[model samples]
Target: VYVETGTGELVPASLQRAQPALLEIPASLDAYLKSIGDKSRNMIRKARKLGYEFRRLTPEMLGQDIYEIRTSDPMRQGRPIP
Candidate 1:
């Protein structure tokens, strides 16, 4: 699990409840869609139709966007956000 931590050094840790899943990023979005099943592909298409998009946050968006995203989940990783 490559979950990001604030700490710089690598430290060993364990979670009481963890369902680690491995995901592979295909060479292209079309290839990714092709790899998934019919249901998943449909769900992704639906989200796209709903105007949901995938974009990397720029430096200018890092502050507020990250804050909003992190705060939206009251509990993250293994602790409370606040």
Candidate 2:
């Protein structure tokens, strides 16, 4: 058996097939949050209350952080790096 999946409905039509799903990209973060609704908002708020935070990495920290995460167990298990 074989299976394939990807974005863009037009690509499948070129091959005489139809994609099972359509992708939608939100215009902004606010649009994304509104689409997911209140439950997700509450969960994010609770996580923040518990001291979790998210932000972009500083240039000085980027290399070390990327190397650490790429070598970590979770990333290795998901897909081994050559």
lDDT, model 1, position 29: 77
Per-candidate clashes come to: 0, 0
Q: Write the per-residue lDDT of candidate 1 for residues 13-43, one digit (tens) a residue.
A: 6665877898877999789878889999889
Tens-digit lDDT track of model 2 for 1-82? 3334555333322443666687799999788889996999999889999999998878677888877876775546567675
Highest TM-score: give the candidate number: 1
Candidates' C-alpha lDDT? 0.83, 0.75
Assess candidate 1 and give its TM-score to the true structure: 0.47
Per-model TM-score, in order, reads 0.47, 0.41
Worst 10 residues of 2 by lDDT: 7-16
- Tell me how far candidate 1 lies from the true structure as C-alpha RMSD in angstroms: 8.6
